[model samples]
Target: MRLIHLKLAARNVRRQPHRTIALGGAVAFSALVMTLISGFVNGMDSAIQDNVTLYSGGHVLVSGYTVSWSGRLQSRFADEAVANIVQSAYPEIRTASPISQTRATVVFGSREVQLSLRGVDWGKDELYHSSLILSKGDWKSLAAPRTMLMSAQTAARFGLSTGDAVLVRLSTASGQQNVTDYTVAAIYDDGAAGGMSTAFVAFSDLTADLNMKEHEQQAIAIFLKNSTSAENAAQTITKALSEKGYTVSRGAAPTSGALSASSESFVSSVVGSGAAGTAATGTTTGTAAGSSGAGASRRAAAGTVTYYVSTVQELAGEISSALGSIRWIGYAVFALMLIVSATGISNSYRMVLLERTKEIGMLRCIGYKKKDVFSSFIAEGILLAGGAALVGVILGLPVGFGIGLVPFNPHGDFGTALVQGHLKFVPSIGQLALILVFVTIVAVAAVFLPAKKAADVVPVEALRKTA
Candidate 1:
């Protein structure tokens, strides 16, 4: 606590420039690595959370479930009445966006691709304006009837661009095969996972194409004013809907079919059914208006219903697991760096202890307490490690920024984690604090044994041995 102890510690550190520099340098390097790595990982995790939650999946997803032989999820078409009831009941919901989709074979010259024809209320969908990155063209261009947006990559692969026409082959909900040429309105890069190619159209156009009623939607996506409250909102909404006689069913959740479905498989359904060719086909049961099937009886069929409520975190479980794995890797890296830095620090203190043994004995003989010597040594270690860590952090900022300057588009499985599939370092105050605490503990621990050894020596014996 005295100025004398401070002066003595400074003298001891200056007495061995090389040893101090070696220990300090190790701490500096470790701190630099820690700062950059943690920042990078945080950046990547944030991107994925933002993009997936905002675009592909809402913070909470609401839809129906059906048990079908197909492993893939099938949409449970709900009437507009359901959406109205839910919204009126829960004003916590900002919007319950209606969306429907169906399989279609799109052809442009020799390049033929099977994709899902998605109908969205683009005018009301804020996600596109907020996070949708346009690779080319604009949403306004897709406004005309029979016009849709495609992935920038898909557009490139087909040698198609805005204003070009692509042929769509689909079977309407009316049980009719229809082939129509659609204009390419715009192209966007959905940099999230799955490399999904979605061409969106107005909700009205899709209903006309699918022969679906105006008040029906395959799924309803609920967006809340505060996204953090997604889980609670989903729970409340699900409970209210369940009370309305729409019981939840056990069924597989649907996949965004375009990216997952193969052209060959989807085309088989579209190609062979003129009688039931690859064209659109529709079906109706019961007797015709003026005819009967031999002996027909009128009996009402009982209806079955099921609902599935999920949060964005639950839907993106794989991504959460991956981020966890990345954190574990960071822990390993941090531990390894600390271990390596500690060894260097311990060795440096060991050398200082050996050289200062006689001096420590002399201090004890001059009425200085062993605790004083210990404090001095500990203080010296702090200056060496703490000062170095500060310097390292300062130096690391530019390096981290330099790395961020490069384009980081994480795609595929890892890529899906990105909000817009880009990476940038955003340092964590807590993580940095942990790093600093680590530096101090390791530094002080490294000095302990050596300082103890020096302080315990006998002064007269030490001088006799030196003489």
Candidate 2:
């Protein structure tokens, strides 16, 4: 608190340049590592979020499921009505894309690849139109019926060019194999953003091929103006849908296509199919006509749908888990680095305490209190750590930016999917400030015992030893 003690602490710190540098180096190194790790994690999270929003789904996803008595999960839904309700009710929603997809094999001459065939509404889907970068052909050509778009990777593997006709083979809702011919309209590059290569076709064309009626889709993805509000938005939407006589799932659906029983019933039937169809699918006559289970089956046959709502966090189940694991590992490394820095501070202050015993005796004889000595020592530790951490953070900004300058192939491997064709380092100012404060606290704590011992020195004993 006094200028005299601060002046003495500063002079003492300067007297041992080598020791100060050694201790400061440990603190600086820890701070540098913390900044880099935080930057890398933030960059990766941003990249994954962008990819998921543009390519896979929006921040919030609404999927419809129909479960049969045999427990087969079917991707059949008439989601246009629900999509309209959500869009009209929530001003935060930016876009709601009604999408339908099926597993299909595309054959061009002798070469063939099995990929997901996604039905996209070209007239209303704005996310893909703005986000996808095409390598060949025109995006507007997708408006034509019987035309499809494949990724550049798929096109290259198939040895096919734009305007070529490919036969797509897929199973219908009734489990019958069906074939359709589609001309390649465009090829977009995904940069291997971590998903199966999916081909896109006109919504009407794909739905017609799959025998789905008007305004029918498997899911509706709700994009938000801000991605951070997704959890709250999902909760609000779930409540609204439930109040409107819709059956909503209590939790996130399994991302792996393994859905549990609906909220009301275990036995259900396919939409547009009567109880006779349920019986044909192996449900007993009693099960289809008797109890609550039978009533649920009849309701399902009468077009009742179960909605599964999830946020992008839940949709990216495994990827989110992996990031969480990486974060914990980062924390472990950060703790170890702090411990090393703390040890350096402790050892350096102990030497200072031994060397300054006579100086402390002189100060005590001049009316300095024990608290003054402790305060001076703590201030020195803080200055050492605070200055070092500030320098470390200042140095990390350029280091991270320079690392991001070196480019890598985004489409070559799984590792590249975590970035956007290059390394990204998004250094946060708040994170740097927190690191500085934490390092200073650790340094002061580490020097506590040494400072206490220095303060306990008796004036007579110290002067006698020196004499």
Best by TM-score: 2
Q: Residue by residue across 348-417, what tens digits does model 1's lDDT show?
A: 7787777777788788899988788888888888778888888878777788877776654544555564
lDDT of 1: 0.67
Backbone-clash count (model 1): 27
Off by over 4 Å in 2: 67-72, 192-196, 250-302, 409-417
True-vs-predicted CA distance for residue 381, candidate 2, Å: 0.5
**What is the Cα-based TM-score of model 2?**
0.87
Cα deviation in Å at residue 311, candidate 2? 1.4
